[model samples]
Structure formats: C-alpha cells, structure tokens
Target: MAGVNDQRDDRALRADCGSCFGLCCVALPFSASADFAIDKDAGKPCSNLQTDFRCGIHTRLRQSGFPGCTVYDCFGAGQKVSQVTFGGTDWRQAPETASQMFAVFPVVRRLHELLRYLTEALTLHPARALHGELRRLLEETERLTGLGPDALEKLDVATHRQDVNVLLLRTSELVRAEASGTMKDGRKKDRKKDRRGADLVGARLRGADLRGADLRGAYLIAADLTGADLRLADLIGADLRDANLAGADLTGSIFLTQPQLNAAKGDLSTRVPPGLTRPAHWS
Candidate 1:
C-alpha cells in the first residue's frame, strides 16, 4: 500500500502503528472466543482505542484477553488508508467518510497482503525465471492500491487473488523441486511430502525433515515441531496457531508470514528467516 509513485521496499509493507488511525480497532469485527473476550461489531471503535487513535492496551493486550490483537497485522494498510487514502483525515475528523473508510480498509488490506507476497516472490533466486511476470503483477497490484476509495471498494479482489495464487503455485514448484531433491535427471517426483491443506492439529512432527515441503493452507494448529528442519518449506496460508517451533530450523522457509509466527510457540533456539524477528513470548 505504500508504493505511491515511487520504488517500494519491505519497509513500506511493515506496519508503522504510529502513522495509523486505529483502523484495525474500529473497522473490523470480532466475536467472543479464545481469541477475544467480548463481541464487537464492525464500524465501532474498540473500548481500548484511545482518543489519539492508539490502543490503550498496546503493551498488555495478551494479558487483557486480546491475544488476537497482538497477532493481527494490517501490513501497513492502516497508515496508507489513514494517511494516503484519506490524506491524514481520520474517521473521527470527518465523520462523513467513516463508512467509506471502514469499508475500503479491508479491501486495501487484502491488496497489501498480495503486494507483500509478490514483493517476497521477486526476491527468490529460484523464481528468477518468473521475475518478469512477478514484477509486472507487483507493479500492477501497487497501482491498484493507489486507486480511489470508490474503486477500491468495488475491486474484484478474488479474481486478482486467483491470478497471484496461480503464479505462486508455479513459483513454489520451481523452488521446492530445486531444494528438496525431488527432481533428478530432469525428472520431477510426485512430491510425496506434499501436505497442502492438511489437518495436522496437535500432531507430533518433532525433528521431521520438512525442507521444501508444500504446506500451503495446512492446519498445523498446536502441532509439535521441536528440533524439526523446515527450511525452504511453503507455509503460505498455513494455520500455525499455538504450534511449537522450539529449536526448529526455518532458515529458508518460503511465504511464512509474521502473523503465523506470532500465533505459534517458539523458543530462542528456533531459527527463522533473516528478515523475521523472533516473538518476545518465544523465550
């Protein structure tokens, strides 16, 4: 969402909470569950949202029965929707724009998520063959993020997501085959390790060698991965909630997002990508 008429980088994709207008606290809805203690309707500000548009429980969200808040990320969409889209005019400043802003924020958030993945895809050496198309899609997605609110609300995001998913699938094939020893003598194996959309909740996978595994959309919630090797694994859309990664190796995992890691359990012995930071709770 930060690619306005210039070159963009990872910094643009990282959320700067200070530059936001508490859009996540007000624009999104939540129901009482393990993730939240109370139910909240969309378009209403959370009780913890301060007058300055900051979360009052910022430092103690997990203790306040709001662990979901800590895991959720707007991927810099909040600042872009608040500053760039509305030109620094928050929903409170101009109440008339509140509905439109709230409606458009989610749309832009999805687009920004796509942009993040596209940006990451362009960095993969194995995906160099598809860099031209990836770059084209990235630029186009960035351009879409800069569109007006009306256009954004009316955007066919699903169709665009389908296009991106197609390319990502192909990119995964190239990278995984090269790193996982699944390709031999110009012949590709059937990928016996494929676990796309698998349900492995609470399963034991300790010390498993999962290098370059296709784990897209896998349900790994509460699974054990202690001392496991997950290098070069495809983790996009994987539900890693409460998964244990103590002493696991994820040095080259592909498409592993911050939110997924934030929801998981890990220790200092766990090795992640260079660009990612270990969660404070993963002591």
Candidate 2:
C-alpha cells in the first residue's frame, strides 16, 4: 500500500545528496578490485578527487570500473560534518581533528539516516496524522547540524537513534494498523512487497517476506536482511555492499548484489543482480 507521497519522499531524500560533503571518498578505505582498481587509505584523498573535493572520475566511475562509487551514500552527513561543523578543515590541514571528525561523522550519519527514514515514513497516508511529530523530529535533527564541532562531537548519537526509532515504530504501527485485518482473510495476498528504490543501509530486516518484490535501485548497504524471503524479487540497479543475505531465499530473485550472492547460500533458482556476475555455486 505504498502511496505517491512515499515515492515522492524517497526521491527527495535520494536527490538531497548535493548538500553533503564528499566525506565517503576520504573517510573510507578501498583496495584494488573490479569495483575500485586502486588502493585508497582512509583519510587519504583518492587520486581522482580534485582540490575542491569533487570526484574527477564521477562521470566515468562505472565505465572506469569503480561501480562502488556509484552506490555509495553518506546520508548527507559528510558535507555537514566537513564544512558546517568543522569549518571545512580536512585531516591534511589538522591531523588531530581526524579522530573527532571521524567519530562525529558516523553519529551525524545515523541522524541523517533516521531523518531519511522518518521523512519517507511520514509520507504514508496512514502516518499523516503523526506528521506533526515527524516535523518536530525533523526540525530537531536539522538544528543539530548547525551545532559547533565540539557540541556535535559530544552528542550521544545512540540515545538519539533510539528516540527516533521509537517514533518510527509509532509510524510503522500507524501505517500497518489495518494490515492485520487485511492479513486474516488473505486480503494482502495480492499486494506484493515493493522494496524498489528503497534505501535500506544497515537496516535489520531479517525474516521478512519479499516474494515477487521489485528492489530495483534499492540501496541496501550493510543491511542485515538475513533469512529474508526474496523469491522472484527484482534487484536491478541495487547496491548491496556488505549486506548479509545468509540463509535467505533468493529463488527467482533478480539483480542481487555480487558480494551477497558470493557470501550467501543460493542456487540455480536465484536471480542475480544486474552489473554483477553470479557465483559458481548459484550456477
């Protein structure tokens, strides 16, 4: 029962990446591989990164064998922590600042990630009544971004994430309030789970049913969707780095990530993600 608002909110969150700093390239490490043909140490700028922090190979990342770059998302925390909080000073200028910035980056990332989810969840018609609550949380998160570096670094990110998850649980309850009634008589039998275009990074969706799902363009980085049922799902354009699909059923799933398939238990019945090769076991 996804609605137009949910779709619109999802698109808005995805397109809001311009406001972030290019922290991913600098904060993360990458080794030479089909996805990245060079070694990049954490805190060291990629060779393709320009003085202004823009990716020189952005246009040709995929064409140049850097498919990993195409699927990376920082949840808008990179720029905020880099420019607004720390005043755009990189680790090169002040190496001591790296630890603090790095620590705060992940925390702010969690906040922004929650923001993305809440914003999307608010779009559902069933959750419209809680729009005010959502708006309050969103505004609070926005205000946090404006805090000084010291204050930002001192934040209790785990507490904030827990508080936000409570609100999200309320949101989920509101959205699925009537689903139980629909489930009894097989009212939901015809309704397929459409995870298409979702951003499920580091999410824990274990043991979920996702038959005939359309997961195209989904961002599932580090997601623990272990033991989930994904039969006949579409995964084209999906990003699945570090995702856990162990013991999951991908029978007839389409466009699954290469690493997930490589690490998971699948068979000839499993459908592979696009732009990736299936493991020998799957064949």
Candidate 3:
C-alpha cells in the first residue's frame, strides 16, 4: 500500500525545469574545474543564464565546459520554491525576496533528496519490515518541503538529514542481508563485500555480481561496470564520473543519486531504479 503511494510521490520529486525559475543557476555556486568552465558565487546568477531564466547554452552545456550543470537535479525544489513558497514571484522581479529564496532552496533540495531515498526504500520488498518507518519519514520530509519560505530558511537540514540517514542505513542492511542469502553457493564464501572508500578508478568490473556491496565513497572514475548486478549496493558518495554503465542493473541500488547517474555513461540497456531518468547522453 505504501509502495503505491511512494511511486506517485516519486514523479512529483523529479526535476521539472520548465516549471522552475532557474533558481539553480542563481542560487548555487560552482568552482572553475573540469566539470565547470567558470567560477560562480552563491546568490549570483550564472553568466550563462538568460533573461527568460534559461541556460543560454543548455544544448551545448558540456561543449561550453559546464558539464557540472548537466548532472545537477534539484528534485523539483526550484519550482516549489518559486511557485508555491514564494507564490509564483521570481527573485528578479522582487529583489528583496532573493536572499530568503536562495537560503530556502538548498534546504528544500535536501528535504526532497531525503524524500527520494525514503520513497525508494519503501519499494524494497525485502525491507518490508521497515516500510512503516520509511513511509512515516517520507511523510515528515514531504511536510518539511511544504513549509513557507521563512520556516524553510530556518530549517536545520543537516540535523534532519542525519535523522533520515539512520532509517536509510537500516533499510540498506535489511535489503542487502536478503540479497546476500540469495547469492550463488560458490560465491557465498567470497560475499563479504566491503569496498568502502576503495580507489577503483577505471577498474574492469563487467558483469560483476556486486549485490550487497558496500561501495560507499569509492572513487570509480571512468570504471567499467557494464552488465554489473548492483542490486542492494550502497553507492552513497561514490564518484561515478565518466563510468560506463551500459547494461548495468541498478534497480534496487541504495543511496544512488540522479547526479551520480548523470555523471556516468550508460545506454538504453542500463536499468535504473524508479524515478530516475536515463542520462540524455546515453545511447
């Protein structure tokens, strides 16, 4: 029952750029690096942002040296802050509202991210024992997203995120424990997968049975994970930049974020969890 509700919520949590006022372009800062061409400070609109609140080089963001922009997803928080919290008033039109709006954007973005994880957790049948708690946290997180600008600006997002992470960690444990039990008999002996913080850059791991693996904080830059079975794997903070994900199955992957997928290379055959869109660059 809660699973059904989660699927519905998932759609709303996706980024609707057309409905947004380009808050990401103005509210977030980026340092000059391989991912971005130029330095931008918080609250200052990106030089590429046009009068219509759209990226001037949206079609050629990567070519324009703004690859970082391609991976950013606000989880629909931009539009919610623009239309709902501020009542459809844009920061440009009302300059006085700019600071508060900027402050609230990140807070709501974090809440929406937590909601995304909670929604995904609810879908894990193996974690059914924790579904009730996941649903409750999802509801609470959703409520936080609906708070007004003043309340949102005052929110302690870090503390709330810590609280939510506890539930997510528990959910991951339950789901992965089940996955471990189902591993092939021969591989069971070698299933003590704890690769946290491993430097796996450009590693050839095609078709690897990485189910229930702890890949948290692993540096997988340009790694080949083609046809990999990543079910129940914890990908929190894993650097997937330029990684190949063609034919990889990440359906039940835990803590995998849209930005992480966007940073990697994948194809139509790559299977992702619900609510995540395949990267446009993927074949």
Candidate 4:
C-alpha cells in the first residue's frame, strides 16, 4: 500500500490556499497580457487580495480577466513559508520581515516542486531499483525545506534541481520502458515521437495521439492539445503554460507535475492522474 500512502502524502503537499497567506499573490509578479489583466510587481500585495489573505476573485478569476491567477499553484510552499518558516507571522503585522519572506518563497517553492516529483518517482514499481536513491534525495530535499528563512533565501535551488534531474531521468526511462512494450509490435514507435526540448509554442496539435511519448522539457506554451491522447506519456519538465487540454486524457501519464497541470487549461472531461485535481476554471 505504499502507492496509496504516497498518493495521500501528495494531497498534503499540494497547494492548500486555505492554509496559505496569499504568498504567490504577493510575492510573484505578472505582466499585463492575454493571461493576466494587470501588471504587478514582486513584493506587492495583489489588488485582489483581501485582508484575510484570500483572492477576492477566487471564484471568478477568469471572468475578472485574471486567468493567470487561476493557473498558479504554490505547491504548498506558501503555507510552509508563512507558517513554518515565518512562524505564522503575517507580513502586514511585521512589515520588516516582508522582504526576506518574499525572497525565500520562490526558493522553497522550487524545493517543494522537486519533492513532488521525487515522491511520485518513488511510487513507480518499475523504478524500484532507483527507489533507494530517490528516497535519499527526497529526505535531503525535505530537510532543505525545513531550513530557516535566512538559509532558505540563500539556497541554490537551480543546483539542487540539476542533481535531482539525473535520478528523475533514470526513473522516467525505467517506467516508460515498460510502457513502450505495450505499444504496437513492441517496436517502440513512441520513441520516435520524442519531443524533448522542442519549442512547440502555439503548435496546432489538437487530437494528436501522443500516447507513451517522451515530452520531457518540451516547450508547449499556448499549444492546443484538446482531445490529445497523452496516456503513459512522460511529461516531466514540460512547459504546459497556456496549453489547451480541454478534452485531453492524461490518466496514466508519468512524471507529470502539479505545477505543469496548474498552468494549463482543462475542462471537466480532461482526465488527470490519481493525485492531481481538475482545474476549477474549466467549463
């Protein structure tokens, strides 16, 4: 039942806005574009953020012309920084700590993203050979997340992510190798569909059969993926920002992360894996 336990833990590690102090809304900046309605600067509280630290347009972010907000997920970093790192202190209550708090938020956010992938990698039975290494990295990453604000602000997240990427690549290869066997003639046809590091920005891929495809690090920005069959596909590090996934099926996709999903557009019919949730803005 390790997989079941892992799924439960995944839920806990997800973005819990209820427990957060609007860190993403305040710490991050966005420019006025098709995705966002207004330009905002880092360290400034979003105009829509309420005194209670909740988005005023939470229920109608898209309608309010702030579709970007609907797709952002802090991956539980907001609450961890606000409650654990800052000792539950609000920025409004202690203005002096605001600068350091904003600086540390993104650092821990990256660490939490790594933890999410490592946790999922551990659940793949085909990658059992690498489970020990995954666990060790997971523990080390988790320890980094528990560091104080000063330590977190000074963390080298890019270096840490580079280290974790090596094991993640191995895990993806192991799991996808088993999936490749289920392809036609067992000839690895999907391997030919590799789109690694390809710039697919706004590509018209509607209804494309991308099952079992290797899409690691693909730039899918604003691509139309409606009705695409993405089952068993490895989407690790894929930039799905603004990608249309209204009717796409991702039920068995491997290495897909919540942040990737959170950045995409999907509807009620879009089938996600077990641990991920459907985006609320989807009609």
What candidate 2 gets wrong by more than 4 Å, as runs, is 1-21, 32-34, 88-99, 177-283
Model 3: per-residue lDDT, tens digit, 1-283? 1123333536677888777789999999999999999999999999999999988999999889999999988988888888899999999899999999998998888888888778788877777888898888888898998898889988899998888888887887777775655445544624688888999999999998888788978999999999998887889879999999999999878879989999999999999976677988889
- State the C-alpha lDDT per candidate: 0.88, 0.64, 0.86, 0.85
Q: Give one clash count per candidate, in the order shown.
A: 0, 5, 0, 0
Which portions of model 1 show Cα errors greater than 4 Å?
1-8, 182-190
What TM-score does candidate 4 reach?
0.90
Task: Tell me model 3's lDDT, rounded to 2 decimals.
Answer: 0.86
lDDT of 1 by residue, 15-123 (tens): 9889998999999999988899789999999999999998898898888999999899899899999999889998898999999999999999999999989888877
TM-score of each: 0.93, 0.58, 0.89, 0.90
Question: What ranges in model 4 sit over 4 Å off?
Answer: 1-7, 182-188, 267-269
Per-residue alpha-carbon lDDT of candidate 2 for residues 199-238, written as tens digits (9 for 90 to 100):
8888897877765556666888778867777654555456
Number of the top TM-score candidate: 1
Model 4's lDDT to the true fold? 0.85
